[model samples]
Target: MKIYLNDQLVDADEAKVSVFDHGLLYGDGIFEGIRLYNGCVFKLEEHLERLEYSAKAIMLTMPWTRQEISDAVCETCRANGLKDGYIRLVITRGVGSLGLSIKNCDKPQLIIIADTIQLYPKEFYENGLPIITVPTRRCNPAALPPTVKSLNYLNNILAKIEAQHLGYQEAIMLNDQGYVAECTGDNVFIIHKGVLITPSASAGALKGITRDTALEIADELGIPWREANVTRYDIWVADELFLTGTAAEIVPIVEVDARKIGDGKPGQITARFLEAFRRRVCVEGTML
Candidate 1:
């Protein structure tokens, strides 16, 4: 496999970064998980925009232009012979001393790898996934904005560990205030009283690309939807529930915290959103 390191493509085994790099040392970096479909880079521009936003939020300097980064992504996919796959684009604050200060950090480094990823089993998608609510609350937004896709993901990882220890495949994370935030890696959504509801940005949910797509699909299908501060009670009584992300796409949640959701099966509305999402992937955004 080939990896895009900085501006050049190199053998994966040869790609390396300094141990002093702030990204590895202190998680001083941001990243985006993107998907490619049938040679088309699904929502490539949107992903780039988010990356840029994340960089700005952290006051990190992006060394390349949007077009330059986009071209490199396409090049990496081509080098890996990837017609359809997952892309991980990372920009790290370059080498620095042993302290938290960034004064000594030099340039920022970019890395892109194109590979295949199946976030969940096919059977889970068909049968619907059961998830638990973990005790670990999401970090306070004031402490670290949830919108920034930073490398410091230990918070979510801790919640995921708690869920796995409890024998669940996925888990939901609530904000510090006990409001439903999102899952370990995906944005949460539920259908109640014929209305599609999700946590608003103020409620500690990332403005996920797939979440936006789902909302657009809802509008296109004439399905009523809105964003609000969701609670566990709302999910318990929800007619249908689902999660969305670049990796997970749209997967139905049949049960949450041991409470059986509508019929304990993927609801019709969730199925429709998934079907429409699959259709859009093939033809949307930039093609490699």
Candidate 2:
């Protein structure tokens, strides 16, 4: 296996980072999980745009130009002989002092890994997945905006642990105000009365890449859609429910909080979106 560390590719066993790196000590870093399909990096430009947005939001400077980063990502994919896989692009504040100050940090480190990932089982995709709502609330937007996409995922991790302890694979996290924010690692979407709804960014949703793709597909298919605040009741009675992310792609949710959604089966609209998404990925974005 090969890993892209710093500005070059190295053997996975040889890739390493300093123990004092602020990203390790204080979770001071940002990352993007990208997907590659049919020898093409799906939505690669959009992912890089989001990466830039995250860096700017956190005041972290990317040491390389956008073109250079894109080249690095493609190079990493080629080095790993990946035609269909996941790519994780990360930028962390370099080695620093023990204290919380960024003043002593040397520079930022770039790491990219391309590999295959299956976020959920195939049966779940075909049969629809059942999930629960966890008590752990999403971080307040004012405290730590979801748009940053930083390394401090302890909040989501705690929610995931809670769900797993009860024997569930995924969980929904509501904002402090009790409205639906998102799941542990994916964006939430529900179809109701012919209109598709997802939480707005202001509602603590991370504005995921796959979520955007789903919305675009929805529009292309002439499915009415909108972004607004969503609640547990909205999901409980949704005609169809699904989650989207770079890693998770599009997954249908059959049940939430023990309530069966629309005969407890994946809806036709959900299937349409998924099919359209699959078609688009193969022909879209940068080729390797």
Candidate 3:
């Protein structure tokens, strides 16, 4: 395997970062999870754009332009002979002293890894996944906006651990106000009376790239869609429930909190959106 570090591609075993890096010390970093299909990078521009936004939000300057970053990603994929895989792009505050100030850091470090990732099994995609709502509420936006995909994922990790202990594959997190935020690593969407609904950004949900694509698919398929604040009850009685993410793609949620969602099966609209999403990705992407 090959990893893109700084500006050079190196063997995975040789790819290394400083132990004093603030990204590892204080979680001062941002990242993006991208997908490549048939040598094509899916929504490369959008992912880069989001990466830039996150960097800016965290005051981390990028040494390379967006185009250069994109090229590096393609180059790394080619170097690894990856026709289909996942890409993890990370920008971290470089080596720094044991202090809480960014002034201690010198520069930023960039790393890109292209590898295969199976976020969920094939059977889960077909039979739908059972999830639970955890007590770990999402981090407040005022503290750290969910829109920025940062390296500090302890909140979600705790929720995931709770779900795992309970024998569930994933966990849903609510905002401080008790509104449905999202899942551990995916955006949540539910269908109610033919309308596609998801939490707005203000609800502490990450503005996911795949979540936006799903909205576009809904529009193309003539399915009514809107963003609004949703509660646990909305999901409990929703006609269908699903999640979207760069890795998770689109997968149905059959049960939440052990209660069956809409006859405990993948709903018709969910299936339609999933099919449309798959077709869209195969034909629409940046050629590697």
Candidate 4:
């Protein structure tokens, strides 16, 4: 397989970065996981926009223009002979000293990797999966804006740990205000009174690309959706629920905290959205 290291493509085995990189030491970086479908990159522009926003919010200098980065990501798919695959684009605050200061880093680094991704079992979508609430609260917005998809992911990792310890595949985390935030790497959504609801940006949820696409589809389909502050009580009584992300696109959640969702099966609305999402993957966005 081939990897994109800045402007050039090289063997994955030959990819290297300095140990002094602040991205490794202090998580001074940002990244995006993009998807390619049938020679087309799904929501490529949106992903790039989000990446740019993330870099600007974190005060990290992207080493290249948005167009350059987008071209590199598409080139990566070409190099891997991929018609359908995933792209991981990473930009790091280049070599910095041992300390937390960023001055030592003179340049930023960019890496793009194209590969296949399977975030969850296929059966999960058909039968749905169970998720439990974790004690790990999301970072307070005043402390760390969750909108920026920065490299500092220890908070999500801790929540994942709690889920793993309980032998569950995923965990739900609340914000400091006790409002439902999101999952480890995906945005959360629940169905209440035939309406789709997800945590608002103020509720500490990442504004995910897939989440945006789903919302658009919901609107086009005349399915009502609202960005509100969700609570444990809201989830418990939800008729249907699902999570969205670049990796896990519209996965159904059957039960939360031992409470069975509507019929404990994939709800009709969830399935309809999932089918629509599958169709969009191949037909939407920029074609390479």
Task: For each candidate in the order shown, give its overall lDDT on alpha carbons.
Answer: 0.95, 0.94, 0.94, 0.90
Per-model TM against the reference: 0.99, 0.99, 0.99, 0.98
Report the lDDT tens digits of candidate 2 across residue range 104-179.
9999999999999999989999999999999999999999999889988999999999999999999999999999
Off by over 4 Å in 4: none
Candidate 3 residues 180-265, lDDT tens each? 99999999999999999999989999999999999999889999999999999999999999999999999999999878999999
For each candidate, C-alpha RMSD in Å?
A: 0.6, 0.7, 0.7, 1.0
lDDT for each residue of candidate 4 in 109-214, tens digit (9 for 90 to 100): 9989999999889999789989999999999988889988888899999999999999998999999889999999899989888899999888999999999988
How well is each residue in 206-257 modelled by candidate 1, as lDDT tens digits?
9999999999999999999999989898999999999999999999999999
* Model 2 lDDT, full chain set: 0.94
Indicate the worst ten consecutive residues by lDDT in candidate 3: 279-288
The Cα error of candidate 2 at residue 27, in Å, is 0.5
Query: Which ranges of candidate 3 are over 4 A from the true structure?
Result: none
C-alpha displacement of 281 in model 3, angstroms? 0.8
Residue pairs clashing in model 1 are none
Task: Return the lDDT, model 4, position 10.
Answer: 95
Candidate 4 or 2, higher TM-score: 2
